[model samples]
Target: MSSSRVRKEVDEALYAFVDRQRPGLLGISEDLSPMLSALDVLLAGGKRLRPAFCYWGWRALGGADGPEIIAAAASLELLQASALIHDDVMDGSDTRRGQPSVHRRFEALHASEGWPGSAVPFGMGAAILLGDLTLAWSGEMFDTSGLPGEVLAPGRPLYDVMRTEVMCGQYLDMLEQARGTGDVESALRVVKYKSAKYTIERPLHLGAAMAGASAADLEALSDYGLPLGAAFQLRDDVLGVFGDPAETGKPAGDDLREGKRTVLIALAQERATPAQREVLRRRLGDPGLDLSGVEELRTILVETGALSGCESMIDEFAAQAHVALAAAPIAAEAVAALTDLTVAATARRV
Candidate 1:
C-alpha cells in the first residue's frame, strides 16, 4: 500500500480506539470532556511517520495486510503523543503544532474561569495527568489490538524496552541541559536514546517481531533504522534553527532560544572564534531573545560551517541507510515503500 493509504488506515484505527475510550471516561464524569478535547486537537496533526515505519516493518517480513496490524501500528501514535506533550511541559514551550500546548491550553482555561489557586500549577498538574493517561493508553491499545495472544507475545518485550529507553533518554536530555555543555559526543548520545531509537528502531523491531522475523532480520532492520533515525533527528535540528515557522509550526531559531545542545550548536561551538563564542554564550538560552539575536546566531552557525557540517552528516547517514536497505532481505514492495518513506521523513518541511 502507498504511505498515504497506510496513514489513512492508521488514523482510522486510532480514532476508533480513542472513541471507544470516551464513554468510559465520560461515565466517570463529564468534567473530563476537555481532556478528550485536548487529545483530539493534538492527534489531529502529525506526519504519522512512526506508525508508517511499524506497518512497513511488518510488511517487510511478509506479514499480511490487515486491520489488526494497522491497529497495532496505530498504538505507536499514542506513545509519540505522550512524549510530545511531556516534552513541551518540560521545555515550557508556548505552542505545539501551531496551537497552544496542552498545559498552556489548560492554563488559559483556568484563567478564563477565574479558578482558585495559581493557574500555573493547575495547568502543569492537568497536563501531567493527561500525559500519563496517554502513556497508559498506548500500552492498552497495543495489547488489545486484536492480535492473538501468542502472536503478540514476542513484541511485548520490545515494546517495554522501547518505553524504558525513551524515558531514560528524556532524562539524559534534561541532564545535558542542566550540565550546560555542548559536546558533540553527549549531544549524539541524547539523540540516540531520546529520539533515534524511539522514533525508528524500536517501532521497526516491534513490527518485525510481531511478524516472527528472525534475529538476522531484526539486525538488518536496525542497521537500516538507526542511521535513518539519526538523520531524521539531524534534519529536525536544522529545521528547528532555519525552517519557516509556517512550515515547521514552531518559531524560527526556537532551539537557540531554548538553548538546545544540538549537534549543530556543538559543532559551531567547537569551531567558533572568541568574539563569536561570546555572542553565543550571551544570546543562547535567553528566552527574551528577539529577531536580531536570532539572525545573529544564524550567521554564526553559517560562518562557522556548522550548517554545512550538519547537512553533510545528514547526507552521510542517509547514504548509510540506503546501503543497508539495499542489502536487507526484505520483500520488494516493502523495500520500495521504505525507500520512499526514508526520503519523505528526512526531507520533510514539517
Candidate 2:
C-alpha cells in the first residue's frame, strides 16, 4: 500500500477506537465530551510521521502489510497526541495546529459558561486529564492491535523504554529551561533524549523487532534513525523561529515567546557578542514579545550565524541518515521509501 493509504488506515482505526469510547465517556459526565472533541480535532492534525516510520520499519523487515500493522501503528498517534497536549500545557501555549489548544479550549469553555473556579486552573486540569486519557489509550490500542503475544513480546521492552525515556526527557527539558541552559551540548542532549530516540529510533526499533529483525538490522535502523531524528527536530526549531504562521499553525516566533531553548537558540547565544547576548537574555522568553522584538531576535539569530550553523548540522545529519540507510540489509523498496520519507520529513514547512 502507498504511504497515504497507510495513513488513511491509521486514521480510520483511531477514529473507530475513539468513537467506541464516546458513549462510556459521556455516561460518566456529559462535560467530558469537550475533552474528547478536542482530542478528535487534535488527532485530525499532524503528519502521522511516527506511524509512517513504524509501518516502513516493519516493511523493512519483510513483514507483510496488513490491517494489524496499521492498527499497531495508529497507537503511536495516540502517544504523539498525548505528548503534544502535555507539551503545549507546559509551554503555556495558546494554540496547536492552528486551533485553540486543548487547555485553551477548556479555558474558554469555562469563561463562556461562567464556571465557579478559575478558568486557568480548570483548563489545565481538563487538559491534563485529556493527555492522561490518550496515554492510557495508546497502550490499550497496542495491546489489542491483533498482533499475537509472541510477536509483541520481543518489542515490549523497547515499548516500555520509549515511554519511560520520553517522560525522563520531558523532565530534562523542563529542567533545562528552568536552569536556562544555552550551551549547545546541553541543548543537543535534550534533543536526543526528548525527541531523537523517542520520536524516531525507538518507533523504528519497535516495528523492526515485531518483524523479528536481527541485531544487525536493528542497529542499522538506529544508525539511520538517530541522526534523522535530530535533523527532524532541528528543522522544527528553525521553523519554530522562522516559519509562516499559516503553515506552522502557531503564531510566528511562537517558540521564542515560549522560551524554548532549542539548538538553534543555543548556537546563537554561544556565538553572540556581549550586547547581542544581553538582548537575547532580556527578550527571548517574554510572553508579551511584540513583532518588533521578534524581528530583533531574528536579526540576532541570523547575524550571529546560528541559523546557518543549524542548517549545516541538518545537512550533516541528513547525509548520515542516507549513508546508514544505504548500508542497512533491508529490502530495496523499503530503503527507497525511507529515502523519500527522509526528505519529506526534514524539508517540509509543517
Candidate 3:
C-alpha cells in the first residue's frame, strides 16, 4: 500500500491507543484531570509528521508491519506533540493553529476554575514539565513494544541522540534570538542545527537503524533526509511571511514579528538597496512594527527578488535530497514514497 494508506491505518491505531491510555493516566488517587485535559489538547490535532518519517525510514530499511514497531513509531509522534506544546509555551505564543496556545489555554483553565499562581509562568512551567513527561512516556512505550530484545537495543542509542539533538536545536534557536546569528554561513548553520538534522535526518536514522539497515544504507538515508529537512524549514520560513492564516494556522508574518533571522531575511538584506536595507535594519526586530510595514517589507523582498531566490534555494535542497535517494540502495517503492513526502512536506499548504 501507499504511505498515505499506511498512515491512515496507523492514525486510527494511535488514536485508539491514546484513548485507552487516557483513562489510566495519573492513576485513581489524585486529581489528574487537568493534566489529562492538557494532554488531550496536545494530542487533539497534529500532522503526525515525525511518526510518518520514522515509518518511512523503517520501510526503507526493509521493515514489515508488526504491532511492536507501530507502537514504537506511535510513541515518537506523541513525543513530538509534547514538544510542540512546550515549545509554544516557551515562545509565549498567543495562538497556535489559529487557536489558543498551550500556555494560554492552561492560563485560561486556571482562571476559569480559579486556580492559583501567576497564570503565564505557571502555565508555561507546567507545560514544560508535562512535555518532559511525554518524552518519558515515549521511552516507556518503546521499552514495552514487545519487539525482540535485540531489535530494540541498537535503536536505543540513536533514539537517545534524537532527543538530545532537538533540545540542542532549541537551545541554538534561543541563542540566535538573543544575539543575532550572523552571515549567510551562520544563518545556514542555525538552520542545520535548529531544524534540519533532528527534525528529519536523525529521526530517519533512528527508524532505519531500528530496522537493522547497514551503515552504508543509513548514510545514504541521511544524505536524503538532511537536505530534505532543510528544504522543509525553508518553506516554513516563506510561509511564516506569505502564507494565509486560514491555511498556515498562524498570524501572517509571525517570524518578522518575532524578529526571527531566517535565511530568507538574510538573503533579502544581502540583496536589498541601501535604502531598503535601512528599512529592514530599523524594523526587523521592532516588536511594535505593524502589518502595513510587514507588507511593505514583503514588497521590497519581491522587488529585490529575494523571495524568488529563496524559493530557488528551497528547490535546490529538495532536488539534492531526491538525487541522494536515487543513488541510495533502497527499494523503488520506498524511494517514491519518500519523494512524495518530501514534496508534500516542503510545498505543503500548512
Computed on alpha carbons, the lDDT of every model, listed in order, comes to 0.92, 0.90, 0.78
Model 2: what TM-score? 0.98
Cand. 1 Cα-lDDT: 0.92
User: How does each model score on TM-score?
Assistant: 0.98, 0.98, 0.92
For residue 95, model 2's alpha carbon misses the true position, in angstroms, by 0.4
Candidate 2 lDDT over 116-232, as tens digits, reads 878998899989999999999999998889999998888788889999989999998888889996689998998898889988898888889999998888899999999999999
Model 1 spans with C-alpha error above 4 angstroms: 348-350
Q: Residue 192 of candidate 2: its Cα lDDT? A: 92
Candidate 1 lDDT over residue span 1-350, tens digit each: 98889999999999999999999999999999999999999999898888998889899999999999999999999999999999999999988898889999999989999988899988888899999999999999999999999889998998999999999999998998889897989999999998889999899989999999999999999999999999999999999999989877798878889999899999999999999999999999999999999999999999999999999998899899999999999989899999998897688463
Model 2 residue runs over 4 Å out of place are 348-350
Candidate 3 residue runs with Cα over 4 Å from true position? 26-30, 348-350
What clash pairs does model 2 have? none
Report the Cα RMSD per candidate. 1.0, 1.2, 2.1
